[model samples]
Target chain A: MAIINYANKEVQFKIVFYGPALCGKTTNLAYIHSQITETNKGELVSLATAADRTLFFDFLPLNAIVIRNFKTKFQLYTVPGQVIYNATRQLVLRSVDAVVFVADSQWDKMEENIESFRNLDENLARQGLSLDTIPYVIQLNKRDMPNVAPIHYLDFILNDRAVCVPSFEASATTGQGVFDTLNTVSRMLLVKFARDAEAAAYVKSQPTPAASPMDGVAAGLRQPQAAR
Target chain B: MQSTPIVTIAAAEKFLKTLEEFLNHSEAFFALIIDRGGTILSQSGRPPDGTDITILAALAAGSFAATRELATRVGESEFNALYQQGSHFHILMNAVDDDTMLVTIFSTQTTVGLVRFYSARTSEQIAIQMQELRADCVDAPLVFTEADLNTASQIFRDTTDKAV
Candidate 1:
């Protein structure tokens, strides 16, 4: 519910990073903030420290080119990676417009990564939103590590759960593929924004107001119907 | 809710000229800038009327006030944005720079394709003006006083209480 006004116009969108501990979620943001011109990004503020980790969240405001005179912006955040931070992660997922799950591509952390992914599904389900309903992407980081779990195995688990989503591979330490990953997911999210606007218009053009927020805003865009 | 009362004559003339130019360039059907209390500072659009805004603002203010209390109780130092959508309208509020609110009513003609782009510019512009207005408001601002409340209550009693 944060209202952002820029250029006398306002555009609001949110992106959340989800993944296991040390999966390079923060690193991706550090790289993006560094790579882009500072003018395009505001101060990267991290909230209080909880035992030396992100206590609440990290917020970075990034501006996109204006369309039709309305400005577009994204608030990027990363959930604390420790398993103990489950409640905080769920809070971050609330009202998220897009998600980028950073996976640790090493053999040792395979189980941790898989469990984190499952946690994401459960959390989203509780909110009545699914990964499928919102724009979601995955990044398999630490590819340079030796004996990393095979991408195929990772794919099998994800696809097997019908959790298929846009994904990439990279070594976050080396800053590879991170920006490209964010850019793609952001573009997809914008497209979803367009779709939502259309749904809003159609809903209003109706002869009468819909019975509920669920009926009006759901738009059948994110909710997977049985047909699929 | 009735459309916002034509702002004070001085405020109305000034806002109308500037906002007309703004609307022409941006092409948003209707826009409003209100204080946190939901008082209409200045507006440009086919807002219903003053009487409507009186009730609408009360409802919106009640919602904001309740949410503020909710946030405080939960130890949330700050309140986030607020929005209410109906069949023909989308009501959006963002706390810009901790003062004034940027509220807009969008019709079907406004597109997501175009809204973000225009809204950002408008937000920034409104933010600056609102800061100044908030300052002036502190000095000698309009307030919905207890007397106004008593008057309203008596009128309601006269209208509904009489009927009852």
Candidate 2:
């Protein structure tokens, strides 16, 4: 869920980039941080081990594209993708509004991709959410590699959901398909948010039905009657 | 799904005032109230030049979450506060509620004892305000039309069209 602060006229969304080890989740963020205008971005913060593997997560804050007089800010995060870091991954998923699943495209990494995807599902389930309920996009990354699997195979394995989500083929190192993945996910999130808000507003606008005598009697029976 | 939290202007003003008072009492260089998810809700006092408050809030929340996990591994439910001592600057983060935290950054000018004392008091006050804010929060619907969505999409495309 987004945090909307009327005081600052700011609406913020948390987007997490999740994938298996060395799948270029941080590479995607680093490229975005370098390309975006300085005024529109904050410092790129990475908590990594001495060997440069992500120890905790990578965070980047971006302010872009105001809508309806409110500045839209995005707090982008990338979780440590190693299997042992599942705990940290779950923590990073907290309060995330959208996700970009960076799937490694190399044929040899298919099993790790599947495992990470299942881990993502389990973590989201712990928060009472699922891919069907949340807006997410799949990025078939490392497409520039020679041993990459075909797009159709990756889609059949990962995007075989109730509804096929937008997936992009990318080489994050070269910035290919990075922005496309981000832009598509962001647009989907905004549209879904708008639709949900509209539905909630409609429900709120409906008049409540008056309780009949039997309903009142049942309510009275459920709770002790107040003294007259 | 948990309801999205909204901080109204009045509520923000109240929180800022509380944070300002905490800064004054503790003589901290900076103070902030960040949600557990790492979004900064309110802040007070001036940060050093070249400091990015947004990153500060995000890192603080991350540090706090990691510490809480450590606490759980040690058989404790959670740690109430975290203190980091640097040679020049120090930070004290206190849990305001399950969903929010109070972070104070100070220098050698103030003692840790004083900052901790004031942070505890301020956390209670902010927690009360948070309770009230949550109770009064109405799911303010975003009245976005299809045109609005199209305009937003166009803006994003324009911004990213030429990658620097």
Top-lDDT structure, candidate number: 2
| Each candidate: RMSD | 21.5, 3.3
For model 2, residues B95-137, the per-residue Cα lDDT tens digits are: 9988899999899999999999999999999989988888776
Q: After superposing candidate 2 on the true structure, give the runs of residues whose Cα lies further than 4 Å from its correct spot.
A: A218-228, B1-4, B139-147, B153-164
- Among the numbered candidates, top DockQ falls to 2
Tens digit of per-residue lDDT, candidate 1, span B82-122: 65667766665545445345555565666543544555666
lDDT of 2 by residue, A1-228 (tens): 788898999888899999999999999999888778778888898999999899999999988788788888889999999999999998899889999999999999999999999999999999888999899999999999999999999999999988999999999998888888888888788788778777767888999988687997788789966899
Q: Report every candidate's CA lDDT.
A: 0.61, 0.89
Please state the error at residue A91 of candidate 2 in Å.
Answer: 1.3
For candidate 1, the TM-score is 0.53
